[model samples]
Target: MAHQTRIPKLASILAVSALGLSLSPSWAARSFTPQAGTWVISDEVDGKPGRGFAIDVQGNTFFMQVFGYEKNGDATFYAATGQMEGDTVTAPLLRYQGGRSFGSEPRDAQEDKSIGDVKLSFRNGLQGTMQLPGEPAKDIERFIFTAPDAAYYQTEQWKTSSRMARWFGLNAQGQVEKSWFAMLKTSPTEPMRLTLSDGQTSETLECSLTTPSDSIRCVAANAADAGQAPVVKEAQFRLLGAQVAGAVSLQAEGAAPLQLLGINTRADYPYSGGVIVGCCANGLESFMPGTFGYAQRPAYQPSNGTWVMDDELTGKPGRGVSLDVQGGKMVMQVFAYRADGQPTFAMGVGDFAPDPELRDVSSARFSLQQYRGGRSVGGAASSGELVRDEGEVMVQVSGRTGGYGMPAGSLAEAMVQFPGESAKRMRRLPLQPWQTLEDQLFGEWYFPGLSYAGRPLTVTLNRREGEFVTNDDGSVRCQFNTQMLRGECQWPTATGTSGSSGPIELQDAFALSNSYVRLRDRYGNLVGLGQVPLN
Candidate 1:
């Protein structure tokens, strides 16, 4: 069978109010502190956070209430019956909803307390009938919680003894009789190695991590080199919990320290222009490019930083719009077109009815009609999808797989136009074609359902030989240059419709269309396509 996995959600128990029958009279006799606070765990898989409540009844019965779901946003809760002997407690499931439960099979256990010589073994399988409320209970197709190494509470704060003693809890058990992992950095001069140890045997893999700079510095070696130095692009591992320090750097402006603290390193992933992450390791989300600090608590606070459009947008047929962004708020000024192509709309954050031609304003997703090709429109809203064809945008961030964290990275994007349009006139519009995974595509794309925008399932493609390939292993290992394109489509019509008047809702109504295409090197570094028009 394949590996069964559970994506971690770093959700904090906001609150827990348990009103129930008192513990068994025999339990009350002992000194048992029913711990009912918050416990956070990071799922290294999705880079998103998961949350739940842990309620100890009379220090004997363990109740675990999981409120967070996977990327699909589902919720699950389970209760187990077991005894707490000293610091160790193992509970079997008596009743479970939204979890894997066989006819009378018990779920896993939860222990806020630890034992001195604890060798806790956690087993979570997909061998039970399950349901998602409306769906009938069936054997789960994939069991992600079976990872054996997924012991809980191996936090970064735990001292060497805690780590060596295996004092932490295991979330799930892996199928691999033995599993191992090694850690490494992404710079050329950095020393790194991969070490693996099965219960009885151990192995270590060694290699040099190089960047573009190293390739130039060693030209003589390049001629006789077997191949390009193996660049450590992405790497990730469970920390139980670890104190991690991270930062984001880019050539364009806008990236600054984000000041995130106490993030469960679960749901962390690299995206187009930035990284998606969850704090406290509870729920999953994304972070714009910048620096980050991780641990058991918040490390810093964020400052109010803002930027304004370089020039004023004069409307089409007229002048376009002028805009500014401050403290997360957007300001716009509209000017009408003049006979001499001068500003016709109002200047300086002008307040006027929005453009009538802008269709489906309230919809979550919208389509770009068409743009005059090769024109760079200025402004944040004007920054649409980055396309690979033009070689403009590229991906700069990475997931934790390579120790290249998935939080706080630069965010930027650009749009493309149809080939037949004039460059000057096309510069006035925002809608364009195809999206690219550039340094700006670094942020994220959120879909309420299985796929994004309810059209074509978006996948980051690494261009092989003028074609696209999926990062199945989630790592980019190419012998030649490649581009990472964040592909999404425009919903042109409805269930069976074709053009603009087809579908009203975005769920599954989108027709095939290119949002944007980003360009990247074989090592997964972003290379800009063209300049965005600021005025």
Candidate 2:
């Protein structure tokens, strides 16, 4: 086993000291002077944290990047806006990305190139304030300069671990119960989901930002909760880079008052410009074997079980192995040995977390056992955390041994399960690259679809393009690249005999996808079939 490094106390910001930016000296005066470079603004409400970045240009324009999270980390909020010089900086209302706070209404047609005035003034030596659409006064925060940081400056990448609790709804007991605390990994667009141990029962939950703050609501991805009630939570803070600072928090509607969390910042090292290095903790590990998706190998032909390591199992560990277990968990074992086949390093075992990527179709679990020629090592207990996003989960493991030597062989086993009722609701996922073309071609196609009215009939999909032309007699006329086909299709209302002969009356309504073929049916009822592939 490799030696482990000593970790610093939680109170120390040494790891990300350089990544934390510093506020302008004039923050105490409540006056701000805009700078012409990259800077960060941080906020704290209740116990949550939110971060914002600004890239200023020639004293005339400034681009802003904002991010915020709820107490559970699942309520992530973020946006990008630009401001220009004027009597006062009037920024466009902020919006969220990859989050679900924005209601169903289509987003405003404003373009990113549209620049507006955004005033910047300091409030104190380390505090500042700004205004948005709904704010009565200015929103307050602290600014940090990231270029000159000691640790973050020297380190090109770093990682931090944080906890998030999703507030679904109150329980029957009236006590505020939360889903599992989720682990959040932040990197520009590549965020990692980690695990949260709640002592007794550990569960995986998704984490995201809802809004920058209660005062300035950012546009979210899904706004099903729009016009509902609000949530009350505070904001929290942590400095990550030199001259740069950040914050996180939660916002909700109804019942409770909006609560903001803790806010704090510290000085960073000098500018050591290069690349920003990311960080990771031992408690977190990836579940994907090498590249994701499917891979083909000869069936496990018994005698061909000669294990070998893939780059993914880098560092230590002997010949690597992979197996599938139905939804619970899996245990794998690896043995390290000298070239002579004599054991050197102690046997090691890895227990993988349930696979979140496939949680919808199936769940997974993993376990690792160390053995020397079929003998057990006896001291193998591993722990893992599950970072859940709607359906999938990611597991990380840590192993230990008193003094075992390397052996000649290793093995890994996995379990995949389908949680009939305990599974979380499945969120519609983004399509894969190859699926994009199909998604467009089959855009609105619906089989015995649910949204349509009246008696629904099952519809078979053939070809599709932009407009879906339906016949006056209640039939489907589909158009593909240049090919056309007719079908006596039935929607919710009427069922018709399948035939190919007809002078179809293609209607004005174009088919986005065949969910509900829009037809001016003078007297027929409508029921839509679910979507399907033409092939």
Candidate 3:
């Protein structure tokens, strides 16, 4: 019996040795495929919430997809592939290809120049330093992936987590009551649908998910709101999970970006500059294509804690600006000059009430007094009390743009008459690489110099909330398919209005020219699509 036991033990030892040798360096370095799912990641840095890593595993590696607003209020999104060996993960960023992919291709460093290599050595719970290129090593804490139907969602824990409520838009109930969003199942294995209703109409779109396993996306969808067909409605959310989801309608371009929960969706970001000065003209940028748009603007820089604005135009006579805020008092001084070295400086001093609480939302109202410069110099008229409405500096920057030349100080911003049309109508946006294109499609349809029914008239197409209508004040045609999704607009009546003429039928009348929209009917075809402009 003892001999038999020894033989068995020897056999067991041999088997264990064989297993250990097989799991040597070669085997260990192969790959570790983690369960694919949605990961809500954040840091102890500010405790902000953000969606993270969606990965798919194959035999020896994983394909990755991540999209979100970063801490700095910029967007980060891309696709990549990487390998995991134990707790170490390393991969290079790749260009995003749609549903179909050729996974066998080698990583192209030149082609995928936008994204850098991703490497990390993690401890337990997947928390570690993400050593990305260019950026310093980012410390990621409590970074873990969970399925859409994560256990925390089923319970009440996630809702109580700070920032999570705001991220999901539970805080928006204070603004509007009927904010609605739903996760829909179109087919058994088909991609899920996220539907948003904005009273007048609803916009439905497929979730930005490629796989049916588990995923989430950062997206902006066009909503059929009370406005026209091109009116865009946006809401950010994790598309799936057992927990009840929350969403808020994002504010329009000119307003501060509504928080997209975990993503930093603030539309207007802070940019540091010096001071603003306007003597003869408030030099706001002109969007006109020629000489006006190319005019030189006064420069500004920070001096100690105050700001100095100077046109620095060697011989061109204009104004120098000095702006300073000490304690709660603000002063704006415009130093003007004549071509013959004559001086016409102006000064406006006022008090600014600062909020000890909610400093970001503090309001500032001031009426700049014209202490000098009543003369018209070099054909430019100058003088006025410029009243700046009180509001948070950040809010004022976006809510009142194009009026102040990028915050450093707009020379024409305070001037009432020097820049009349351009300053009043111009709307400039902070430059961002991530694009939202809905606004490019709205406005009037212009078919220049036309008289229908031998009478002077204008033909206009109206796109309002899922309805496209032809509104010709003249004798123009308005025949449409009458069906919404069939790609047609509102039809003109059989009996003509005073200036009404032929009723031209149209199919897919709305045509796109990069950023602008055009009406494509008989009038459009005759006049040419490119010739028709949206004013």
Candidate 4:
């Protein structure tokens, strides 16, 4: 017979304050928010396949849910929610039963008993330690199935951007049809590349932007290798805000030259320029980079802000959801009315996993927990306690468009299920109007060194009385007009370098966010502020 270990149940909650845990002095100088995602005991992710922990952090509030097995091999889950002190959080884990499950009638989950107090201390966003009752502390880290591709791009010093554009037109049978195009640009000087695919075959095009006309002209980049006449002889595309309008001329060996007008089916963010590109894909599909080698899929982080259902924008505004995604983890809060028309909200935190059915879609499932009996508005130090399990909510995001075009990861589709209710579809509601180029450009920023071995840079800008000025004592100063996405900046020249004394002309200025910006200097070299901490 094997000796089995069992989790002890407690009638009373442990007082964590009596533990007298000390806080780190370094954490006082900088704010460190633990990345929200699946966390597991270090080196035990594969060894313990059926057990792990999911942590969701909203501001300073940390919620953790642990899924494991009982001594008899029955599955069970424990949850704890508490405020974080510096980089540490301690709370009493609670077990609940008799809650609503799939296809069951609605019933509140009652607290069964207190398991024990659990303490979580983070060394950084990706690494941490977890201390469970009656067990030794274990090392932990964020569970990453695949590393983000953006990290690879940064390591290789390759500046890249990408976007998705839809093309709609009448087909050969005179029926309306639509297709998608993935646009990628390596650098300012590199030719713009366009990829078109139909789930099976793909085509590539090398394009250039024609000045004055402001039209993108493209030629087949892979036609000759296929031993076939180029399907696209010439293409002229003009980006109209989020919508793209263009005409493509096709050539075939046995067919006459044909011209087709193309228009997009949906609206998106305004176009900035080629520098707005990111790593080669936009979640829809991946493209071969040819010379760029294998580029991993970038981890998708939906824009941080409030999101409402698209259909509910004009009505009385009954209910809405708030979404905040950080470091690949997502925390969603759904606010709605209860049975008696009383307002209530439920929140969940989890990681977005790749969807099995849709190649371009990623979905996250959350065990929604409702908290009650906490501090009131303007009340003294008190915390909320989870009172019941509300239900489950899942959000599926696709076609993330951002980084100079819109807010990065701005658009997505979602579904919510509460207890016995069926799932409902929801789309991200666009609340704010599209920001002007000036609005995007005006902000304080911090960027890592542009050179391989240079110090980080901090930049502050303000526009006063029709003029832009840098508030910092930095060597770089730039000015630009809203009408054109071009500017001129005075930058320091390397010692013993030969160049004109005149200011360097810059173009393709794109503000991906208040903290991230990209530009191209006259020499076609890349210069921009990336997401580095200003502090």
Q: How many pairs collide in each candidate, listed in order?
A: 109, 160, 21, 6
Better of 3 and 4 by TM-score: 4
Which numbered prediction scores highest in TM-score against the true structure? 4
Task: Sort every candidate by TM-score, greatest first.
Answer: 4, 3, 2, 1
* Model 2 residue 166 distance off true place after TM-score fit, in angstroms: 46
Q: After superposition, how far is residue 143 of candidate 1 from its true place, in Å?
A: 7.8
- For residues 287-362, what per-residue lDDT tens digits would candidate 2 score against the true structure? 3377752221101000101122222222221222211111111211121222332221111112222223422112
What would you estimate as the lDDT of candidate 1? 0.20
Rank order (by lDDT, best first): 4, 3, 2, 1
Write candidate 3's Cα lDDT for 1-535 as tens digits: 1111111000000000000111112333211123222222233222222223433332234344443322332222344444445556677653321111011111111122335686665442223456554545656432222333434233232222111111222222221123223333233345445455433455655554333333334244554556545222444343221122223344455533332212111111012111111111122232335554312221211110111112222222122233333222333333322223222223333433322232111123343222222111111222222223221121111111223333222211221111111221111111111122221222233232342453222334533332234454423323333332122222244564334322221111122111111322221221110111001
TM-score of each: 0.18, 0.19, 0.20, 0.37
Candidate 1 error regions (>4 Å): 1-61, 64-78, 81-83, 90-93, 96-184, 187-535
Q: Global lDDT of each model?
A: 0.20, 0.22, 0.27, 0.42
Residue 268, candidate 1: alpha-carbon lDDT: 24
lDDT of 1 by residue, 1-535 (tens): 0111232221111011222323333321211122221222221233222232222222233332222322222222222334443323444322122211112122222222211111111111101122222223223111123122323112121111111101011111200111122222122233234332222333333433133111101111111123333222222222111111111111125433111111121222122111111111111233344634321111111110111111212111112222222111112222121123211111111111111232111001111111111101110111111111211111111122211122221111111111222111111121111233222122112111113332223233333322223344432211211221223222323364422211111110011111221222222221110111111
The candidate maximizing lDDT is 4
